[model samples]
Target chain A: MTSDNTKPWLRAEIAQWLREGIISDEQAQRLLERYPSTPEPVEYGGGKGVFASLGVLVFGMGVMLLFAYNWAEMHRYAKLGSIFFGVALSHGLAALIKDPRVSSSLHLLGTMLFGAGIWLIAQVYHFSAHYPDGFLLWAMAALLMAWVLPSLSQCLLGCALLTLWSAVEVLEFNVLHFWALAVLLLLQLPWAYWQRSPLALTVVLMLLALALLVNSWHLQEGAALLHACLLAAMYLCAEHFSPRMSWSGCGSVFRRVGLPLWLALMLIFSFADAANIVVQLDGQTGAAAPLTWSMLFVLGAAWLWVLLDKSLRPRSPIQIAECALLLLPLLVLAAISGGVHKVGMIMTAANLSVLAYGVLFIVRGTSSLDRRQLVLGCGLIVLLVGLRFTDLFESLLARAGVFLLLGVLLFLAGLRYSRQKQRRLQEQRHV
Target chain B: MSRLRAILLLLAIAAQLGTLAYMVADKEAIIRHGHTVYLRTLPLDPRDPMRGDYVRLAYSLNQLYPSRLPGLQGLVPARRGEVVYALLRPVGDGVYELDGIADRAPESGVFLRGRVQAEAVAGEALRVNYGIEQLFVEQGQGIDIEQRQRGEAGFRRSMEVALAVDEQGRAIVTGYRWAPLAISVSPAPEIDGAAATPRLLVQLKNLADYPLAVVDNAEHCGVVLTVVNRLASSAAAPCGRYLVSREDIIELAPGAVHRFTIDLAHRRWFVDGGDGLQDVREFAPVSSLRLVYRSPAALQEASAEINLWRGELHSAPFSLRGFE
Candidate 1:
């Protein structure tokens, strides 16, 4: 008898063989029985989950606002006791409820109440704490609740709270809080992996990028170049690790988020003012902070590792362009450190790189028949041309001629692409 | 959930509750056992949307002039946002003044732990922030207290904050009281010098029955004078930063008056301009003048034996017709 793990195609071929008289009917039947069709999966509670989550969100927000009302007339202890009671009661209800969605929602409500309790306690005592400390404690509570309840919503609340903590510190106090970043990497990253949540991981990636900027904000002069390199590195790292990731579509998601970020950074770098900051004019040369050098080195090493990947050789023009794009900032960085201060040359190089990447994307999209890539490519090119036309060129006649040429070229490309697509379809139908 | 998981969940909840309970207990303990002290302060109406309306409590202990302490001249400077310990010595019943500031916790003394909001060079003024700086009142009640603190007529000095400072130097605001102080401006009868500017003799009086201290330093000065022109435009003397010494503070007995002169023709008078402050070289005739005094200095300078009065006041508008 064939195993149950037998491929569907093998069973199909066997049935066909029996019909063609290549096998006896009994043999085909016996083989087919071993590979019995698995039952279709039953999806449960889709609408229920959505409604439950929404209810949780609304209920949480209401509870927070109610708490903020600061029941001033009530006895302080009574207020504190009521908040404590609400948190425990919601959490207890969550424990009793057997439905997963309802239980998760209840847990979320409990966590939100718990946060309110912290602030309520603060209000009751008229506590004038270092304000960020409140957020840190709130984040800790949410994270701990997330861990205990194993709830995704709670995890998200924790992430948001932690980000708020870091933001308040960096923006209000102008202090770079490393502990928040450390917690994100060490605690939240693992939680994302544990939950196998691609969305959570993406949020973690974006937050990490923000945290990196905040942490290295002291490196004012060298910040842009260092950030550009880091952004490119993140993209490469995501691409390289996507396949090995446990969850499906993780790589695609990373690329979807990362590509635009990389493009935006590169676009900004293409401007002269931003580019010249890589080598300051006032004579303080090199990366201003040692951390900048350390980051550049780490990013360089990561790129090298990705480049030396034995399985995926850079054979395609698009892949080669990507590799070059990754190196462009570092090359500029090196030039700056080596006393090259030609601002015009750097600006030209940055602009040309953006133009080259735009063209590469268009070519790759056309060949691969990916509409999203094609749209992105066209958008990028249009943005570059639009920016240049808006500010760079002064001659209206030259601008008009360029626009006319661009329109004609785009029209011809679209026409050729449609013809090729039509021919391919016809050939497929004939075959 | 299994038994172990249930226990773990209980533990987590207990841990969170414990953390909150610890905060409550900590503050309660301070109120229970900490030394009670009165801080001089004035309030302005400000609201925190999340936490309701609060009267921003500007205390006299907020800024300490180390220049007053000749002994601290060579000590290491505390940078902004760095931990600072302000040693406070009681000058009267339930009133303490800053004795000295150290970067570290003092070995043994009654002190309030603070952060250096602004660092000053040696022998200059540095600002210290005790965390209990904000007094969160009931929603909308802040404006009432603020209004009382900035009185309607000629007086504004009123609010007195009570704080409990523990041995560890942490503090929590406990309560507030009202102590009114007054400022009066009148035309000066005498102009001695040939080139003397037209002057007004201003008086800062202790309207309350308690002895009070006034900041007479060149920096903040005891009182600020503003001249209102006929068009309702006003020009104010710019407050300067000068070394504050023991002599800078004048102790006023109950119902006592301290007098100062304001020169209307001084180059220092500036009016608000579109770009910035514009020099008020001249003024329109028949304009009225007003004097305002605000001090966020300690109510008592223990070393100087002066009980500093802290509050903001606006003098009743005085007519400048005779002088002009």
Candidate 2:
């Protein structure tokens, strides 16, 4: 309080200003606070950076070693031990690293070593005739690892290798192998779902289907049918699960394309079997009348259902085309059942119906159509009509005539439409 | 309201269309052609009762084993998409000589040839003649139906052979075609048809790749039983019956029929000692005799006795059809 000129923590000049009251004590204090703590020059050291870099080098060497140790040449026990050691050591090293970049790199290396080790183990077990259970154990281990490291590539690798092993086991007529593979597939679904990995989901679904196919051979008719039904169910489940994942652009495309393709294939497969049912039942029971009539009834009902449903969602061109195509085979079957002569009549009628629909679609699409809609609608109509006429006019002369007529008409229409559109646009601009 | 109603209506319509489509697709015709008859069914496998893996077909429609065909020596220029047909001339009973498209006029008995086509359908252009393949009892039942039901039938037997021919129609047999197959026929059962002639159900279960052909003999005459019915047994559980319920028989080419006698009369007619009326009463003959058809490689001729007592017929259990 008595004007201490030698301020305890301040420089001499600053202390004088505080004592004379040239500057307020608060300002002096503020100035002192702003001054650097240490004015002395400091020396530099690169120790930590060097140490971190060394760690990375060691991890890289370990990766090289991991690759060099060929699991294929090693005995089963050695392979198993090596895989265990490799996975543990690499993962542990990864966990100890603190730097994000270094840790992620280490994690990746560890996962690769782990995956290679597991795959090697599977291969060894797969080839070993004495140890049938080796494949199952390997599959289980891979499945467990997938769950533990959901984001790691190791998970997918594990799932895939396990799937292959399960396939072999199934082919060998091992029921246990079939169920085990199924379980692994089922486990991958949720993991893939949780991880939002569409790729993993797709692979798992495909593998499941393959396993079903292999197992279907040993099964009885009832069992085989059941297996097919199960496959259809699994596909349905996949379709349901797909929307939940953060699909990539390509994945989205596949979802759009692949789902429809898969569904169409399923429909074809189902229809093929359904068609055979009529013939099979007729032969077995020697009762063609009931079977034929029932088939017709069923076909009619299906046609009507498709037409009504399609009318409701008129926007979906694919659905409309599918429904229409589905009707052709049904009509053909009906015609065949009636007689060879009736088949001819039905073919003509079907041709006319398709042509009319095509023309109507073309007109509507052209009038209201954007370019894309016009192209799609006209293209579809032409294709349908062309296919129908090909079937309708069995004689080469008639078919050639129809084909030429259609080609000329389509060209003329397209040319006229373009010319008219251009003229209209020019007139509007002038006005 | 309209949207919801529309959705419901759409669904109803779809269901109806699906049902109708299912019915139409299911319509199939079972045509009987020549000595061969065709029945449409969801395809079935002809499994052998004894062998777990193979089936014994009722008829042979597959190409002959490559070894059996006379002159398929080396590779021939096969068209890319054109189906190649081979004409097989019979060398002996159940044996055939093979000729390619280039081969000259051929003597014929029952010729088995195949066209390799782009697709399974009748018109799919054939690619080449691997060999003289035979048709199985149940071949191409419906469009795509055979492939669909193949899984349920277990293992399939394919005729293995390679055939080649020069432009002159002269054929050289390259190698003997053999399939890992076993074929057998059940003894004719002793059941009287509504017509009183002993009705027989002969099953040709093809257990191997070689198409099974039983030369129909003049002695055995009845509708070649295409539809086989399973006669009930008293035992709750019976084993060794591969085709327990029903099956379709494969059709054979005309004039290829071989004759064999199926004796309907029983060997024993009288009992030695019994009750006074029973003693005087003669035992009526009811046992059935049938010809057994084993393939060319079979050690013993395939035959069986189907014993009938009081109207019940019993067949002797045999080994798996293909293995024997």
Candidate 3:
């Protein structure tokens, strides 16, 4: 077993060492008896079992479909009664689940069913025109459930519902909705922090990114550049303020949310179609540009906090450079949509930056000896290369050749890295 | 801490379930015990896009003139889309009419809280939907209901919908009844049209036991084009360019089939809604041709004054692509 393997078979290793005269019998016995003799009230399993929970989700959906199928035939009270019964019954089942994972699954099913039930009743009562209003009520109810149950699944469901609700609100109206969303979410942020849930905070930041996206959709042809800027700023503020915000408690959860988002934005902005959105000069898009000021103001506050606080310095050069790259376009567009002139150059710069960022990620990951980061970096580079080939060449032959060439290069690189890692491990073992 | 969480969970469940039950119970009570009101609805109403599985309904009296309301002076609507409680008083036999709007729910009379969708200050016609603007049917049923309703002729067939409304300003649609069709109109076969002029085939089947009589002496009963564009979103889209009104009286007997032909080639055509008469040979390819003919109540020709339940009849949408 390697030293860094998360769960080590230490007892067996110690026993073997003792047998081989590396340690005394007493030492082996002492080490073996190290576990606590006391029994715990709630015993948690090692990891979340994904499959069991998935089964329950499928079953719950099946049940919901069953109700909707018989909707017209069923009695009005029976249809309404069944929903309450399902919610209560599912929660009742959740109470019996001793396994943390299965319990969480029950809670999720209960939450999803609750949502379905609300929609069903809404249909039954003919509240069809004002559909978006239902989401607000549903999200609020989920928040209450999250508070009472306090699980990852419940919090996640609530976050998603609220995010969707806010997105719809923004699409309905631009700045007015954006302001309402900001206030609602910003208020929820402290509550999430008080819960010491980094997942919750990450959800908040994620929802903000989604809400910010409404600007691009509602404002322009498809202002991917603006969306990228807003998202980058949001990620930076969250990462920087993590310590003060109590996001320090649950480590790497923010990374789980932010990295994929950043990658998606990069991929989107890499395309020429997205660039057209920036270059196309439309009066409506120009007027809507001021709607992003509230987000930028929040980011500015975070930057100000970093500058004034002596204890909290900026993390590293890479982040600062990326922030600069993100903010550069915004700074250029500050006159609010005159990025039209700078569009072509901005497109080239964005494409180059994404490729360069991928390379940097590889170098940083290799130096730190983190395989996930290295693979992720390599995967991104390979993806970008594949994208370029597919975009440039319509013929399948040219694309396949490029794929084959990249595969050979990646295989050689991986072989070399493995050899180097092996040599390092040998050196450490000898020491 | 675990015990406390369990208790909290119990309280939360109770609260949610309690509220849900309360709402549902109120609605159910309306269905069980409330004054029943019926609306005579035509099938050609437009639908809202947001509502996927439902049909958006515009009632004939959805937009009401303020003068119709007995106490209309007090009901100045402040804003649009505001949920206003509508006070409906019984005007005739088993028919309750929308009397007025109020900010607060009325303690007496059949009341319904509806969001005011559109208001015409000058026209004084306020359009409101009491959450009953939609009829959510089981998936593809909306299309079917719409087709049958539109395909039917007015005098012989009709559609009626009933709803139950309580004093608490709640309303729920209770039942729907589509009129029966005896004489169905369809497009004439293209093979027959190739030889002569393009015409419609009106097939009248006596689905009932009573004898029926219609116009056999007149050369034509009604002339209308049923533009069959499957590419069209609505059944009534192309029909707007055609026409909807005209009455040709006919009499039929029990267990009989009456077939009438209307030329689609070149003919003098009068617009359904408008009185403008023009020579139209333009209706070449058609899907459905609606035939409107009145039937005598008794088997005699002079007994045209009496109109019974669904005395009017129209045909289903028949298929036709091109005509000579």
Candidate 4:
């Protein structure tokens, strides 16, 4: 039988790699022979995962809606029995079926049915209201199904519910809360990373970490600073993990959660009274954690150190300016502690840092001829300016002026982008 | 590895099914052969006994204070969620009183095993949860049970939990016994040279066929009766607020009455004799009294576990009434 080389793109990729001297000629030939040229088999795409998932979702929804309606007339045992049977039947089907899509979907459906049965039992035996024990049971059952089936979607479902379970746990605030979320994180983190789902990983990590931080640190303002720094460090790690670190690009991932938090803290602290309010709020819970400030400083400094020494070496003036962004918060904090009259100095420094970061991004994008970054960078400056205007001036006239300025700036940026795109298209034609 | 996984999967399924099977078996056994005892439950918003989707069954036996269990002297307080054994004494045909408490299992008689929940009602009462604290009913029946437990006119409805306690003191909440709860307040004549203010005697009778065991009952705090004026105002006088724990258990026998005395003798009323004002009892406003407390009652059920629900053996709520 001839070797199956149905996928010609593999050979094309090998050839390209060979041309680029990434692989030896002999290696390319070996790859080619390993996947030989053969006639393609005729096929129709059947039982696509999406369709199966969609069908199951629709069926599950129908079951939920049907059962949700006036089942009060039915025997409690009957309702419980049906839910139990559905879970057992779906799982039984999952074990029998070999088609991955069908099997995984069945597992997902079974997991959901199991959760429904848990609530059914609760309803049958009147459980407590506003209790989270049911959620814990539901999460465990879903996670168990996910583990047994090794289904990605089931794992995702488990993770999402687990997060909700943790959130519900906040009311009780048991010491066990931290451990449970952490355990779920350890269990699901691998699946998220293996799937290269950055968004999912980001969400899970953020949730688990935030829950742990809040419980351990008791939602103190200082904890927020540490939490932001810790997450930013993780995002930086994810960004630096590899070139193909994510299914989607990992550009400015740390900024997704961290930069906004930093900016928010800056904006909030930019007001003269916010710091004293935060201190008083901290007093209500208990003693403010003694090492909170130290933790914030250590984690923040570590992240800043990593960014400067390891990731970006500040070889150019623009890079050096970006590095200075890390130091600005510390300066702001120092100034605030000194007195309230010096608040404008910190605010001006903050505005300058934001302005510098924005301009640097815009210049970098303009130089590299990248459109998205240009829009984003210009957008940042406009947003910051608008925020500053609102914070500084309460009057409608100042607000109107801010809005007019933002509109003109955006219009100019858009015009410049269109012209740049045209010029780039002409350059490509000339090439 | 796949073989190991298969074994683990089987084990997990087995364990889950085992838990469910065990729960069913436990309840069925208690309902079939366990000894029956009655519990007196108070109306917790009888209009909607079923709060949301859950029927919250609060038994009189749920709370245990250190002072209540006198025999178990120096009984180490059980940590929250720790299981403690409580020995019981039959007060009458169907009701039981807490005799003693122990860390280990009880050998014989009507007793109960319960976990320690944090105290909810006034810091004095230690909350003990028998497995039968909550029962799950069908979706809409929660409201129905709640309403039935608290019939119209407020005090006419109450819930009686019949627990079947096995030899081991393990309990199953087999059923609920329903009855009416009523209160009547009357004046008690003052003795010669008795302090000017007379004592108001509020009598509450067990209208149910079974007896009821109550805890920390002296000064009639177990059955709280509040006095209100014509202004529709409920005032907290020293008489009503006075709570002295003289004894732990008070048994209201079947067809028997339990009397509570509200002291109005020591009231610091004011008197103005057209000159300067002096303290007098004449203006004190307590006229008619409304019984305000949820009477706690006890029965035992048979279940080795804690906080489970089984409603098959339940009876109509036990009734209480007061007469002039």
Candidate 5:
């Protein structure tokens, strides 16, 4: 109940005294009562929940196998009866169970059983329609379960199945599944938002990014540029939504995935041959279809909306840098599509952008004294130098010289870090 | 749980069960109200660890030559994965033949909707997959049924799958049976290999109108005999690549019977060892034996005038002691 900073220290001391036999159990208990333990935050029940979900998955597979055994001697009605009975039993058990872990596990099992039933029925009746339709149904059913039961397992399964469905549709049929994307955005996203599960949100965002990338794959030359735009849009969207999010640390998921990918794409573009290849392919393949233009328009609108919203706040240099990074890809894409074959000029600009971004990060990190950002900034420069050395210089002597320079710089950085740590320790001791 | 949640849970469970029920009812309705058509099936029995055994059914209608199809000769050829409809006209004997094909379904006729598995090109057979190309069977029964459907040398049996097609051009396999072919197998007199390793004669009669190219094993157009042990365990004889030249492929006329001699003891026989099935040089006396003939796959050679019989056939079980 005490708000004093030393309460934790005192509580730990009391526990240690109890353990060391200096204080009796009753006295320790009475003292501990004066400072009640802080309640643990809610989490997707850690290892136990994971194992239980896995157990349910395995059990679902077992049930599927048993049905797949295709007991030839059994009548068709018997098989159908068994499938229905199994689904009903699992759902019933899920409903009756009071324990959240057990109930969620049961619900997962029930959802999976229902999916297996769909396939099993197909097996029994020899129904072989579009296989993705089966997955679509399964995903819808799992999503319904997630909505009705309000469980993490159900939501995760729904997301996974929905992704699988979209992937199959795109890969197998070469068709962009707009309906799948619609379901994810309209149905799954709202559920995740309501549930307030960061994990689910992370999955939803990752899947959304993946689905967009896969769906836009047919744009061919436009795909890479579209990807950069999409990723930047995601990052900005995350920033825009962060203020509205009630939960702490939820917005970091988008940045965690998007920023690195954006940087990676920039690094890739910095290579001379990458931009050259894109330009060459664009020339041969010609301009993208009307659909790609419309999609780009939508994505551009979204990016603009988020960027406008972000601009209302006091802008950081890093935000300005990110905005520049997003614009650069669009400029390059437009140049390539406009019949510009100046690969060397574009590559130089890309390389300069990467160097500038790295320097900007280093400056920010130094000013903020943030180690992670500083390391990232240094790592980017190192990677750029290393990659440039690899392709630009064929001779061993030049390569060795580059390596020696890198090694010396790393040694100096390490030495500086050690000195800083020592100084911090001394200051702490003095205080 | 809240009352609203409880009701939702009940609805969810009902929907799950209803989905299963709908699948059953839909298939049943197709069987009841749909037009029944029989098509030939050449199935390969394969085992899946998860799904047990399934027979991969290849039908005669799977491959159609657009050049041969009068209706589709002038039309644009179907690309791979594009949906096409095949108009099935009842030929005779409860079987259907591919009479015509179209990009869209026929207004009023027995037709099947299938995806183009391969591109339709000139002088090449266009492959289509009807999605009814697999039949799940009991564990260990796929091979049995596949073998049984491929009758003995003299009594050739080919399987015909019965399909029920709804009005929407969707079809489901209702049933299948092993039908008869004109081919048969008979043993000839012992060759001059003396007493121990006696030679046996094997013959195949080509019944189809097209010229059949049969792969001659070791220059002998003979079938290998697989022995079934007392435990009902059977292993295939050790197979090796035979250098099949143009001369080695015996092209048979429509009514021609291909006869050749095979020395039974020359090839290694399979026996069940402690570590599963193993092939041995020694042949033990077995209760029953079956003839297995595997033909060469279709030749890519444009000069190939004969249709290569590109599948395996297993003869009905007969005792080697009878020949002895």
Candidate 6:
């Protein structure tokens, strides 16, 4: 047999061999069918082209008719009828078109034109002091089109417009307008599922949540707070349920970066709340609430550290970073309770804890301490120590002196690392 | 190559034409057309100056209403978008009746009606209930006269009417109805030679269409000199003239004529040639003059002024300063 035919025969022989004893019947069938003959490419510009052209013409004519009728000036029902008819015609055309290229392009153009046409009709009606019933229709059509196509541009436009319309309706004090936004979010889900588009889904969800928050704020204060809390809780739940579904990164990096940031914000808010309570109490009863809530959150963070230590893998950066974050709130609480004088004691303890963690991380370098982890761990230790001295010194000049000393230590460390690398390279060359 | 370019050009033209056609086809029909007249009214009750003499009237383009469906509050809230018509049934002297109804719902309040179904029939009207307290006559017939002679007793009148809006959005006001207000006209003594300058001259003539009475000591009004252009070294010549009661000038009958002259040359003074002439040359100035009259009843006071610098004529600015 010729070279090409030899390859095919060998594939058949292997398939028969697998079918007999080695591989299962299912495996043999899969291998045999894998090399099916290629189908002929589809030809363009025939009956299909004619049909598509006809479809476009029909859709365009329908748009013209809808425009001529001044559907916007008609009653709400009539406007809804016209919009539904127009959208149905456009979508029908999209489905009937056989060629992918023609289908996509036609779908884009037809939907856009239909949307713009409806918008124009509404505007005319509004300006003429007539009934403007086209807005609802346009919103619905845009959302449906977004789901049908799921093209990036279409989805983005539809989402943005629907969100804006919802906001406008809310401002007009119509609570029912939120349904349109809900519809848009629902439409996005299918596209997200189909493409496995996690990033897109996240962004769209965040935007939807934000819209809900803003609308709630306008409608009711308690509602706004509840909505925001729900959105944050949802994110946290999502992170916990499927850790791999976290789009940001692997577990360690996200925990190390995300935990400290989350804790810091919580601390800031707690402090602000405590300050307000103290001031208010001083004005009224001359007794503060003892910063009890803030202290409780701090204690909660400590409990979280102990829990993480037991649950997480030892020497995990996430475990270390989470512990550090959990300790930070406690430090702040101690400072607040004992005044500035006790800050130095808290800082010293934190510094020693951080240094010990850093040394442990360095020793575990064979597994986790890459360049980034090494820098982050050691840098954090130095930062804690430096912050302690700065707080203890209490004067700008003395603080600057402490920073200068820390900077010298970092410079020496970097120099020593480079020297060690050079010695290793030289040793390798001599050997 | 040229054919391809031509085809592109044709495509662009076609697209533009399509857009233009769409816009034209979608253009909103002008449902109603009417005039808006604004006027100030002074209330007859003397104790209430807060009810100023002038009442501003507005003729709206369209009246709007909420969508008729229940539970649709705050949706399309602006009422200026509904096609509305007002039916004015004549009430009595100085007052015509007003019943505003939308073309879509006749029983509705006089407010604009919106969201009428597409299949709605004609003659359906909506009512708008503005709850306005008073109505005044439309403005536009009697001439607006600024100054009248003291003790002059005659009447002045003005009128306007709202048009009827039909089911098909047609607006029609059938006949010109009269809105009349009675005013007592009076005449005042005119000063001689009020304007006699070569560059500028002003002549006051009695042009009243009805009989008027002129009185002496009817409270002489002051003439304000807005600007004095220059002071001649010669004694300041009278730049203005005021009649000393009724004796200074003859009483003017309807259509009667009067004249006055002011000479700017009399005020010019030739001093020692050098410094005095320089001062005079440096001091070129302009002046404005206004005529003011006060009535014995304290109700008929008016002023007329002319600017000398810009040579522009201006009426005395109306003052509600004492009303409230």
Each prediction's Cα lDDT score? 0.66, 0.37, 0.57, 0.54, 0.68, 0.38
Q: How close to the true structure is residue A399 of candidate 3, measured as C-alpha lDDT?
A: 81
Task: List ranges where model 4 is wrong by over 4 Å.
Answer: A1-80, A125-131, A173-176, A213-229, A243-379, A393-419, B1-36, B43-52, B63-87, B97-105, B119-124, B153-155, B164-172, B180-324
**What's model 4's TM-score?**
0.66
Pairwise lDDT winner, candidates 4 and 5: 5
Model 6 chain B scores worst on lDDT over the 10 consecutive residues at: B303-312
Model 2 residue A150 distance off true place after TM-score fit, in angstroms: 2.3
Residue B183, candidate 1: alpha-carbon lDDT: 65
> What TM value does the first chain of each candidate achieve?
0.81, 0.45, 0.68, 0.68, 0.76, 0.44
lDDT per residue for candidate 3 within A257-285, as digits (tens), equals 66577667667656777755655645234
**Each model's TM-score, in the order given?**
0.76, 0.32, 0.68, 0.66, 0.69, 0.38
lDDT of 6 by residue, B8-113 (tens): 4334323423443454343322223322222122211111111112122222211222333222233233243244344333222223323333344444322222
Task: Encode model 5's per-residue lDDT on A256-350: one tens digit a residue.
Answer: 55667677767787777777766664533444434445545665675676666643332545666756766666666556655677777567766
By summed lDDT, the worst window of 10 consecutive residues in model 4 chain B runs over: B306-315
lDDT of 2 at B302: 30
Root-mean-square deviation (CA) per prediction: 9.2, 28.6, 9.9, 11.4, 14.6, 20.5
Evaluate candidate 5 by giving its C-alpha RMSD to the native, one decimal.
Answer: 14.6
Q: Candidate 4's residue-wise lDDT over B1-324, tens digit each?
A: 288776766665554445444545555566577888876664342212212234567765576656546644454445677777777766443655566778788666777878777633332556677766665444566677776665433234446667788777667665576643344445555567453454555555455666653333534434433222111112333235433332544566765555666554333212222333322233323233344443332212422122111111112221112211
Better of 1 and 3 by DockQ: 1
- Backbone clashes, each candidate: 5, 74, 18, 32, 4, 41
Q: Please give, for residues A229-302, the per-residue lDDT of candidate 1 as tens digits.
A: 56655655556554445553455545655766777777876777777775563323333445555666777676
| Per-residue error (Å), model 3, residue B262 | 3.9
Clashes of 2: 74
Chain B TM-score of model 5, please? 0.56
Which candidate comes out best when scored by lDDT? 5
Per-residue lDDT of A173-264 in model 4, one digit per residue for the tens?
34335555665558776665565444545556666556655554554544444344334434433432233333333323333554555555
lDDT of 2 at B8: 49
- Residue B112, candidate 2: alpha-carbon lDDT: 30
In candidate 3 chain A, where is summed lDDT lowest over 10 consecutive residues?
A1-10
